[model samples]
Target chain A: MTLRRRFVLVHILPIVLIGLVLFAPKARPGLRPCGALLAAAGVIELLFLAALARRKRAVEPATAPCDTVTLVWALLTGWELATSVLHLAHPVLVPAPENVFDTFREQPLVLLRNIASSLELLAIGFSIGLALAVLLGLFAGWIPRLRAFAYPIANVMAPIPAVVISPYLVSLMPSFRSASALVIVLGVFWPTFLGTINRVTSIEPQILDSARMLQPDNRTMIFSILLPYVLPGVISGLKVSMTTSLLMLNFAELMGATSGMGYYVQNSITYANYAHAVAGIIVIGVVVTVLNALITKFQKFAIRWH
Target chain B: MNRIECAHVTYSYEAHSRRETVLHDLSFTAADGEFLCIVGQSGCGKTTLLRLLAGLAFPNGGAVRVGGAPVTGPGTDRAIVFQNYTLFPWMSARKNVMFGIAQARKGLSKAETAALADEYLEKVDMLRAADKYPYQLSGGMRQRVALARSLAMDTGILLLDEPFGALDARIRGELQRLLETLCTGEKQKKTVIFVTHDIHEAVFLADRVLYMADGRIVRELPVDLPRPRADLCCADADRLCAARRELLGWFDRTETEVQV
Candidate 1:
């Protein structure tokens, strides 16, 4: 069979099987909601596959998404069979896919509030940290004495995990939110600062020669020439720094915070609400993926010159 | 009066705790509007000499003077076109040219700089690719943009370190002719220090050619050929041929000396 046919067979078949299993005579009652959710997911998958197939003639089929869909379908089928169909797993620990998906419909406002809280903290911490890192990095990289003084200190500090000190920071700071933001900033700042320093120092000699010929003042040289020269490197490094900051933020939230995605999951697990905890975990995954996608788009736009 | 003077300039590079001198008390002077070519084999310090004149680097001894002023650092009065990476990769061709113009003619309005940039790009026949970035351009086209940039600057002194050296034969000849036209046209001719290893190019474009080897200028040859010499078919073809032959002879002698 052709790749497209094979993708349909592997991807679409599992999704159909999942629907069948969901609608089949359940080992217990109250499965109609689960059946409805599975049917809706199957319809969405069908539409997506149709779109992919239509574009296949113009572009090669990306195997990753096809494989991802197949894996997701298989996991859902297995989870439904194990929890609701066969009753093979622990009753409270392993929740059915329906219960997890129900949380989206049942407690959407609460989930949204938690996401907003997490995003707000992330935005503030990430923006402040990245801005400070880039500005300070440019200055520290340009000046010899400052670079010499800070390079070694950053080297020493960059490797210390922000999570290790969050407890102390939380106790020291007046608010848990400030401690979380501080943790994220420290996590992102060192690497970005060091990367900027190295990038500025290693700018191509020919470019430096051309800029120097212009006889720009110190401020113009730093802002106009050096900043643009190091921008591509900075943007490429942003994804890593962002991921680190997110990790630090979540870890801090898990330690002590009244609101956040991490706190939501921690709160669910405290009451042994595995369904809510699993839903919260999935929410975190979706949020991180969406943020990463945005970062990728920004990178493409920023380095369009390349 | 001389526009640029390199007086007994010497320079060296330090590598692995050792100093290797590149220019040994080299001295030369170019009168205003003269097109001077420094021709030498590879590793003969032709580029080093050009850099000294450009004020991109300082000599360990003596000084490079432009218009009776000692060279300190790179200035707007002298514009240089290096062999590679002369244009900023992040900027379009038009922006690169405008950058130089803005530096040289400060206080000009944006529209004025843009117009001047277009004019020079037109002169070099690179107007169509004005919005293209450096990476989008071919090697020859990038060199054309670099040439347009220096030309647009309208600096009195143009230091070219084998600007066309990386191009193929056809493109190199075309650029050489373009450069010759621009340098000798109605506009005030810039004092150009054109460095090349090709003898034919030197004889074709330069008013005076300096042959250097082993950190010293071996000979100086002045070409009296008329402008627009009509390529190798013109009346001055024999003189051009003789100059090329003499330059080749110097190269052969240097090779024999090295073998011995």
Candidate 2:
């Protein structure tokens, strides 16, 4: 399919599923109006398709990686018609897209405070964990004695899922945030650690021989040779690590948290304000997408060798 | 007196997880400023012996020394140009040459490093590709860059492991001439160890030819032919061709023995 068609299909398919689900519940009175919501969603999505059609001549190949503006528009347009325009489904359950956008304006201070707190925790935890992992991984890879000690420990440690211990960690720690950050750290560290060790061990033997010929000491080996050698792999590793850290953070927040995007969802769910809950979900998706894009940009700049 | 000495040196590697000796008790000396070509049939450890001199590999027994100093590892005093993939693909030609200069001339200024690299690249007729990566160049061009990088190191000893072995015959002949002109015409001469499977190549460029069979240096043949040697029309070309024919006879004998 053309990307435009795929683009249109992406928005159209979800409303179709929602329509099918709504009509299936014949006895649910409030959901009868959901058919109208679905119809309006269909219309807005058709408009999106028409807009895409109008610019089809300018469109690049179907496989070209494009900006997310189209995706965001599709998401918001589907959402806007689903709740406010048609008043479909339960009154409390369906939050309007405008209401979600308003959530950002209404509680900007709270949003900023929570986001800042979460980022600070992530920066501290990720830096510490990543630094330690690289150092230890380099040591393990280069020296046989250290490898004997670390390799077994790493094998044992890597499989212990961070989420399983997070709740207990919350109880043990002074603050839930610290525990949550610890969970993120643990979640990111193991894989990166193991990956660095593998990268070091699997480095091109010729290059290793070249460095050995230079007779650089351990400090030079790690700093100049090994670090630069493994940098491309590490940058590639960062995308997955960032994702896992976010997953752990959200999971850790679900159990107990005062502030965060996760806590925002948790609090709204508790108050039975599904609108706020839905808003928080949208926010989390946007934030994660933005962070991932930033990481990709940084990755391109860092590994010009690639 | 930075001459190389190999005293009963041997080398082997594990093949099929079993010990397989490639070179056995090889003994030879390459004096300062001597261009010694090692000619042998394939798999005769000619390349292995060069690796020993370059300190890229350790001898299983005996010793390989340079100017009375034992070679424990590869050093700035000896720069090597292999038949293939010696230049780091990620670096540009200029940067590749600069890397060698940096290793050998540590205290030199940035401008000096750049100028010296350019001078060598110009010598190899590769200054036009100085900013290009290895992959961007043809096989012959890449070898020129490699040669430039090796020469820029200013090493007293140059080890060439069949440096043109991968090229087509025409390019190989051209580069052999380039190699001859570069090493011979210069005021400051270097001790060279050239390994090749081609006897003609050995005779055309070498001051002395060492023939090997079954991992041993069986004969040493000195050319003692005058300089400004040209393959096509030099006065001593007939003498070089005759020497090449003699080396080719040894290769034919080795082939017949293998067949039997």
Candidate 3:
């Protein structure tokens, strides 16, 4: 289906389900199943959907984030009405979406501090890892003997998952932040290094032939030709590395004495505050989205040829 | 002091699956300002001969001497134009010509180099597309740019290996006429070694035609044609027809089912 059609369908399906549950003739007080609040919810849901459909054509098909975002918002609103306003859900265990929002407001300082800590580690670790990967990858790819020696080692090490060794890594390092950053670095380094090698190897033959005819030395081959050829590929590989780096960072934060988004969620679940835990999950989603968007913009500016 | 002497040169290559011998005891000399065309069947070392002349490769035995000095490699003294892939795609036509100028005369400023490139592009009737890349140009236009680049170098010897072989017949005729005009217009003319399998093309253009078979020159037909030579309406047309017939007969004797 076209992106526009799919976008409309995503918003429409939830509205139809909510309408069926709350807009029937007997959805009123006493004699009705719930009250006028449930009927009012159906009207609010329909208005939210109409507003969404108005903006659907402006949305690009491949960017389905709006659809996902709208669905998440609508599902939470429905959950709120079912549990708190209508009293239709189980009493003690099921809290409304209002409780989730209240949980967010109650510990805003704690949440902000943890987010800052995680972001600090993420920025430092990813920068070091990506910079080292590019420099070493370019070196290994350009020279034959270096490539032959480094490629087999990278092949063996790249396939091992970075998350599996988090517990042991956490014990070995002096501080939790150091261990977490190291895990993220290891997580992001290998694929980018390997990708750079493949990209350098498959560069266009005509460009290489022209450089060879010019009889450029080894320094020129690496600086002038190989770097430009691999820049586009490296920028593209950043999107993948960004996600994998976050995965390692969060996993490492989950284990030990730490102040991070992962630790916040882990600590909240420990105290049986599921509402705070859910809010933490939402914060992580927002943080990752913003980080990826920044990388994407950087990539666009770096590569104009493609 | 004004000649390229190939003193009994020989070269061979190893195919991936077998050994192939291309040239054996090949000896020829091209004098100053002489246009020589080497015509032969495919795989008869015609291009290998031009490469040797251009100093792109070395002979397995014997040497190539330019002005009584042995050639080492591709120097500014000689410029080469292949059948195709001569221009770098990333560079525009003017830039390609300017690169030759920079290689030939390094001390010139960028503006001086650009002016020289523009002058040659105008001479070859390619100034309109001087800023266009190779991929953006037609095959004939790219060849014209290649010609302008080679000519702008103003090398002592111009080595063209089937320069117009990839062009269509109509464009080929136009470039041949352009080559003639360029060759005769200069006061101190340049020597040209053109390699082709077309008999009429050789007879129409060259001062001397060297026909080869089995990796050796078998016949030398001196055209002695006049200058300002147009492709049509010339006495050289009749001479070209006669030389074409003679070369075809030689070709048939060597291999009866011959097709280029």
**Best TM-score goes to which candidate?**
1
Per-residue lDDT for A1-306 in model 2, tens only? 766676665555455445444543333222223443444445555755555455656555433223343464556555545555455546667765445455665676887777776677777778877888888888888888988888888888888998899889989899997888788778877877888888899987656655554445688678767887778888888878887787778777787788887787888899987766876786677678778989999998876645
Where does model 2 exceed 4 Å of error?
Answer: A1-102, B13-17, B89-91, B133-137, B169-171, B231-235
Model 3, residue A93: C-alpha shift (Å): 11
Q: Candidate 3 — which residues are off by over 4 angstroms?
A: A1-11, A17-209, A217-222, A229-306, B1-5, B13-18, B46-57, B92-95, B125-131, B161-165, B197-204, B211-220, B249-253, B257-260
User: What's the residue-level lDDT of B197 in candidate 1?
Assistant: 94
- Highest lDDT model number: 1
Model 2 chain A TM-score equals 0.77
CA shift of A167, model 2, Å: 2.5
Task: Give a tens-digit lDDT track for model 3, residues B1-260.
Answer: 55888877888888997877788888888998898999999988898888777666789888899888998875677777777778866568998898778767779999999999999999999999998878788899999998898889877788888989998999999999999888755584888899999887887788898988878887888877677667445566776678778877877877864553
Clashing pairs in 1: none
Which of candidates 1 and 3 reaches a greater TM-score? 1
A1-306: candidate 3 lDDT, tens digit per residue: 776675676666456545544553332232223333344445545755565566656554434555565666567557755765566876434545545555555678999999999999998889888888888988898888999999998898789888887788899999998888888888878888888887887877545543444444677667656786788888888888888888788878888856899998899878877767877887898899888989899987776434
Each model's Cα RMSD: 2.2, 5.4, 6.8
The candidates, ranked best first by TM-score, are 1, 2, 3
Alpha-carbon shift of residue A220 in model 2 (angstroms): 3.6
Residue B163 error, candidate 3, Å: 4.2
The DockQ-based CAPRI class assigned to model 1 is medium
Better of 1 and 2 by TM-score: 1
